[model samples]
Target chain A: MNRPKEIFMMTFPLILLLGVLSCLYLESCSAKKEIQLIDSEPYPIEIPKGFPDIKIPEGNELTKARVALGKKLFFDPILSVDSSLSCGSCHLQKNAFTDLRTTSIGVEGRVGPRNTPSLVNVAFNPYFFFEGGSPSLEAQSLGPIETFHEMDFNAALLTKRLAADEHYQKMAQEAYGMEMKLFVIVSALASFERTLISANSPYDRAINGDSSAMTPAQWRGKELFFSDHTNCASCHPAPLFTNFSIENIGLEKEYQDKGRYRVTLKNEDIGKFKTPGLRNIGLTAPYMHDGSLESLDMVIEHFNVGGLGHKNQHPLIRPLDLSDHQKKDLIAFLHALTDQDVLLKPEWAP
Target chain B: MKTIKVILMALIGLTMLTLQGCDNSGCTDPDSLNFDPEATEDNGKCDFPNLTVNFSYSVDGQELTKGTTYTINGTAISFSDVQFYVFNPRVAKDGVMEATGETHFISFDNRSIEFEDLTAGHKHMLMFGLGVDSTTNATIQPSDSDLADGAALGPQNPSMHWGWDNGYIFLKMDGMVDTDGDNVPNAGMEFHIGKNINFNTIALEIHTDALEDEVEVTVDVDFAKAFTGIDLSKDYITHTGDFPALANTVINNMKTAFAKK
Candidate 1:
């Protein structure tokens, strides 16, 4: 046993070497890979070269995952109290994101007070609600969710349900990474909605110098729409087609219902409703807040007579006195506002 | 052997020192610190006096009691509920407006004990008006399914709006009045008061120091007094035949009434 000490020394180095090597191997195995955070696809969100950024909250840039999830959630009736109604129920894809019914039906066969508005180009709308009560798309998302006659789901319950779902968890993580929250869900939906820009309409093409986009009647209608006699352009304007302000438009003197005044509590705002954009006016039929007018011709006739004889009627509303031909031309112009790309999109289909 | 032991001890000591340095600089002990040793926390308590204002009115000869239901003309009318909202109501000591909190939205629904939550004095200016404001009106859409259960007032309940001519019935005053010879059974009037873009407002003031417990105040709004300047005999009719004419007359009438109050 003369070499016992030497033997121990040799074995010790071997053991230490093996231990260090194993330790290095374990470290290598446990180390995480670098996350490849790909930048989301850039959209044409940039305003025209000279135009200022609209003084509104910028919606988050759209992502494929978020848009996909939003589309799913939009079509899912699970958001309703009874799981019977979805956003798509009221905003059908066939009618360019508007329902044909006069008023939308909600949960438990409940009826809403106003006509279901179209969602096309809703991102460009500065204000929401017929009376412009909510200022942003983010705020508007919660309107149907909380209304007793609509979805009727408690916000807290919705949060808890979403938190529990593994599918939603994955979606949320993909859309927002680690910053996902209930409010972020709303933001993502709004972002997805903003991507629904219908700028490829025939009218847009014609305005952008495509002569073949419009017929002669539609061209004449465009002229009449902007003319002093029609005065439609005063409220409807160009591009997005709305002035984004409240006007009485002479529907009534006193309504049992106050429109915009409900938000402000000001007496002066009585009978005032938000002037809706006329883009895709052909598709979003059963017109007006109450959906009283059935056809485009009826809408023209109503405006022609200066609306109901209410004291608060907008001064801009006067007898158009358009001939039948002019009215048909105006109708044709309205039809040209329809975007084929938007209508045919498979993503929009429920 | 002794040298190896000493070297191992030194290495251990170095490791311990490194750990100590990390603890001091990097890791924080949340339980070690003390917070706010001197200040008393706010427990949301209020100590204020009380006040009351008794309202008495005589129609013809009979003195009106608080809960008495009376038939005006023929339609039954009564003060179902009454409370006051002092827009910018404040607590005051002596003659100065106090910085203390006051109560607001003193209504039949939200009955809070602390009038100080609304205002802080018996000698408070009582500005009052009748009818639901515009903000409250939009919430009550006629087609809203919730309204079917009578949660919101709409056309089915009273048909307040003159069809669609007037968007919504703003104010509803339902009471019978002496018309022609006989007291008309259903002679009632609804003042759907709203204008296009003019803010119509009413104000009234009262000074009170009468109370024993916490100061409680109530303002009496007389519907009869609301139509004081309005001639019931001529302007008041059962049916809203001339909508534009009636609307103009009512708007002017409401503005005058509010201003006077």
Candidate 2:
């Protein structure tokens, strides 16, 4: 063969091989990497009548996959530092998502400072915690995960741990279209929590044209609750049963725990706390911010006698001098607030 | 064998000629550790040298540590934990401020702060906030992409970030004081100072020196100054908002505490 043909013979196979390899690499680069979702059904939240529309963050829309992922993580101990506690440990479904303990118990028996609030109707809350510190549910989820007495786990480490599991990776991808990241973890959890709407109570039913739903005693208690004598409706109004105002209800004479003051640092906010929704108040026993009041009876008595009259106490919180029978009626009315369906809802459970 | 050698030589020549036509891809920043002066192209992987700042706490000329006892104003006191947040570091040359927008969480354990992006310069003034800046303090959730794991704004163990308030505790000095004359710290004393109003800017004029590419500076923090004019025995607790006067005093004292060593 001629010299040119000999060179061509030597380099043709090499050139073809290089071309094939380059095409393969280019194909890999140009191909759109589609994430295989486990399930991505859009979850439309069923807002009850009289309940305000939940404002979900634009980035985090409700999805079945996202809520499912959050529900799984909420009940899983993998987020804890010791892998011994989960959000479910403190917020049980039977207790309207409250732990029933005076204060919450964390991983390794570490005691939390505040009582576990019910997750029901939490999506309606403008801010989180009794102090109203956190601005959003996404931000509030970080509190339990990082608090020393709670999960005591680092988000970086938790993500790293979750990333190791293929199942978690797939779930995270399905939920967030991303790996198991800090944002995904918090956002997913918030999505699930926002879906925990508890509006199907006896009071809710009675107000919605079902007059037989509420008993006569509960109806009487409702009248007193809305009446000017108690002024309960001032802070805790109807429908949601909470005005969502931060107030000093005169829980103590000298406040041991500075409630809203911790958030705002205002002198007037020193002994103030967010007025929690009365919905599910019956199942969420051991009431008050610190769970100081053990039952609905104790809560009514505290309110009836008027709070200890702290310097910054709300003027509306005064001695009602409610009769024992009136107190019982109020307690019975509170029991009517419990939504039996939400308590046993399989979607909320582990 | 001769034909194979000829082909290998041709391939080697082709490789060298091809390399001459292409630009070398590498980090071109002079301040970076892997800076390539000859590179004509940047691959965007620049490994900048860390500018380290070592903060050593002292109380009355003695090295301060957890459980380190000191007598102040005829009262004995000892600390269990002391932590603070440092952010918005800047090195100035003749009045021009060079800002390194970074925040750091400082405790007794992690006192050596490393700034990866601070460029080398002959800086006469070193300024940093004793607490997080208002913009960062306003960030309730520190999981933002910019706020990394060790960032002062991010979550920490023995958390400086208040989950309740959604703000960082600028300076936390938790300890106990001897109230009953036993010469032992028995009563709890805590100064959890934090808030947007309490963020203090600490500016120090150091001797004119050329800060090397990878410089290390030692700063002495006299924590004893943090308790000046305060009765440690009685005024033991201040969570900034709860006790604004005490918090302001501590913050003002801390502003004067840091000095270049």
Candidate 3:
């Protein structure tokens, strides 16, 4: 009994010293760990070669938690009033983020006016919508959400719905350091959309030193595309494949949709629409603002006929006198722009 | 040790009691709307008397009723809907102007509106905007300061906002007119005036006193003045951007139609 007491007396001091040292080390480590858990980490994006830097709006940086939350919201149907349609419902990854419809059908089967534009590489777009009404991607999301025939939902109500979910509440604190708000919803979606960069096409590969990436017909058609006879490069220049010009391409004699005139209230802006990038054109047809042209041949023929001679037609939209063989080559070149990787990328899918 | 523990508990209880005694701050003005009877100290956020405003529509000095036939520019017309937005309301008393930075949706369905924070004195000038201002019209999303769920500047059922252009339709007058020479008013006539450039302000000279409790003010809006230079037979429909000439004439007429009663 005396021997055991002596052993306990000697071991007690050592144990007490170890206990003091452990408390100091653990307190410091726990402080650092807590900060790491609460704060969002940076999400790195691979900017395409030869493209201008993505201009992320100030106060909203790309973070891993924010992008994940945005992706979840993009696929959620709770944004709609009826909870039946989501942003992903109209923008499918299989069709390069386009719905493959003449015009998208919204909540309650309401047919919208404008064709759904492809969201592939939308980060590079200077402005949003075919009419170019919204200047930033963050503001552009509000258009569809509040439209009467689209989602038909209110932003004020969206906040309440998101706040009620514990997962969303926790994620909101992690991503934005606050509860789910209207600012959080818009900014988070914009961050995820900015990550949708598509520059791995065969044409991109060929230009980036892969000699055998493109076919002979695609090469020949590329030369004609940049030539003065086609004049396609004037409006659709390289890198982004668009110069971001809002112009009247003379698609109609009397337009029902006034296009940018609705925003500017100017007579000259009637029938004018923003020129979209041609990165995934093959996957995103029927073409034009109204999705009137059904096929690539129809689009080529429309340009060949000089666009039905509307008064507001672009001065450079005169007929492209190309042979049938050349038309086939142009179609082949457009197909070469299709990036197969973007369609099947698991990271982009739900 | 037990005696010392009792002293600490008593000291903590005393501190809590002292903190509770310091919370005597609240609205103390008897004339204010949110006057707290139990409050001993006054906070600056005391609401005052409210001045209520209601509109009356007239055509040719006659009361205009919905679905009632009226003649304007030799065309028989009947209005089915008449609605507008009133924003940035201000009342001036003795050269000291106070503005309620609020927007309200007014219609034949709901015609009464109230402006609080008025002093108990006669107001000489009453001014309010006919449409949304440039900054508010830029986007459909209302500012955080605005009543998020209130009818003022919030999303409506029929939707006062134009989602395509991301602006609000300030004034909407929809009805039917006898355009095909038929006696019955069957042809649709829609006049939607909006856009930031078309935002107009109407200032009226009113002789009304806001009592310590509340006061009522009536403002007349003549429907005939809206058709002063407009011919409903040929120029019937305008969504502001599609037919700017007719819209410009109607807005000009609307500006002169308001009078305090």
Candidate 4:
């Protein structure tokens, strides 16, 4: 007994059940793969070469049943009020889950304030939306549908709408047991979005010691990008190609639409927006929060001049004064970030 | 032979220990809805109930019984519509919860709202939020369980949701009230309150009766009480995000607006 007491100092702490711990515990218990809603195996979320472990939220665990249900819901237009659009209508797989439109159109031909965001590698994001308001994929899922310009659907009616469908009813019973609820619907959708992994790009391979994966011009551009003078890598970090921190980047002298400030309500965060990952960046355009820039050339030119130098702009953002040839090299590197295989994934497409 | 016999005995001991740990397992989480006391291990079988509490729109503790006008402060206030959202109910002792309640939407037309299921041995004191909390307001989704009931043969409509802000309007009181002590009702009292900042909480003690499953605990909202010390002859129309500060007087008066009957 005396020995046990003495050794207590050297021993590990006892496991305590805590509310804070629950929020960080992302994955569900990986039980033996037992089929429920579908005849499918548990989809293992693939961790890319350099990315950290993906933590699915505590309440939501990615199971085969949930993902299958989510896939059906993602493609279904029934989530919309008028049934004129679906999530797939704007977030097309070919464009790497972005509406190629300058800004997405809404119900009754209304134009929205912001651009339709790309969902590629969205699971890896620390926060959701252009302003980085929602912390989880599940939390961000409800935003567009409630927006008058988007699907314009009330969340309360989802249970009735989903319950009416025989396919959804059977699936709901098999996956969650009992009838359809709002929690089940969003959890399923968030799980399906988690399955969208885009790690097969040539740049990813090149970074992982495959010198032949990328062209020589792209290689030269990579040097300038990571170099201190260019100052791209400081914000657009490696692996996911985004540090996931909010920045102003001097988009305007004064913002017509305040970005991160809308969420945070702080003056310093006024024009700040999330640093979007560079993966599949080429496919998803026009760029920026308003989608004001049309092409890679325009984005490069903006950076070359180091933006308009707004007050809160990052210290690293300054005029590179790059020559025409160097700008082309950088644009070529961005194009190499594209992964063609993501577009061909049948399960992701409608 | 001796070595093998000793090994078999050790294996058997380990098996018995494992079996003993697994026996009569149940939900051990204190926060879980189906918490069991005699459980040796947790089996993750936690299920919370949908406890539906109710409300009765009244005038000075007297039931108006629909379209009934009541005279107070020398004005005739007739309410055409009266509704609000309540969230995160809890049974408390001195302010600590004995059980948790679900978020609900209630109105005069449909006064009943089912909350989360209770386990056992909870008392009369209750606590609930007048509107959606900051976290819920920011992260609301369509399939959110907090919604009272998705409207199907029910009056819990989604129109109460603020389509622009992505949050539900916490309270809406639309009626005509005579502000100048005139016999005729003239002023349109459109006081719809929402947004996370304006959300308030109420800690109530149900002194009238003991708590039971599905028992009605009436919370009163008096239009007369809102006009106790102020004139409502002004425009009084509060929008979703604009002028929440202007509606503070009406919102603060709601602290005394609810009482156990």
**Candidate 4, after superposition: displacement of residue B33 in Å?**
31
What DockQ do you compute for every candidate structure? Answer: 0.03, 0.32, 0.20, 0.14
In angstroms and one decimal each, the interface RMSD of every candidate reads 12.8, 2.6, 3.3, 4.5
Provide the RMSD of all predictions against the true structure, rounded to 1 decimal.
15.2, 8.3, 10.3, 17.9
Ranking by DockQ: 2, 3, 4, 1
Tell me the tens digit of each residue's lDDT in model 3 across A133-193: 7767877786788775789897768777888998887777788776677677887888889
Candidate 3 docking: what grade?
Answer: incorrect
Per TM-score, what order, best first? Answer: 2, 3, 4, 1
Per-candidate clashes, comma-separated: 28, 0, 0, 10
- Which DockQ-derived CAPRI band holds candidate 2? acceptable
Pairs with backbone N, CA or C atoms under 3 Å apart (clashes), candidate 4 = A155-B142, A182-B143, B49-B116, B49-B117, B50-B115, B51-B114, B51-B115, B52-B113, B52-B114, B52-B115
Better by TM-score, candidate 4 or 1: 4
Question: Which 10 consecutive residues of model 1 chain B have the lowest summed lDDT?
Answer: B26-35
DockQ of 4: 0.14
Clashes of 1: 28
**What lDDT is obtained when candidate 1 is compared to the true structure?**
0.59
Cα shift from native, residue B189, model 3 (Å): 8.7
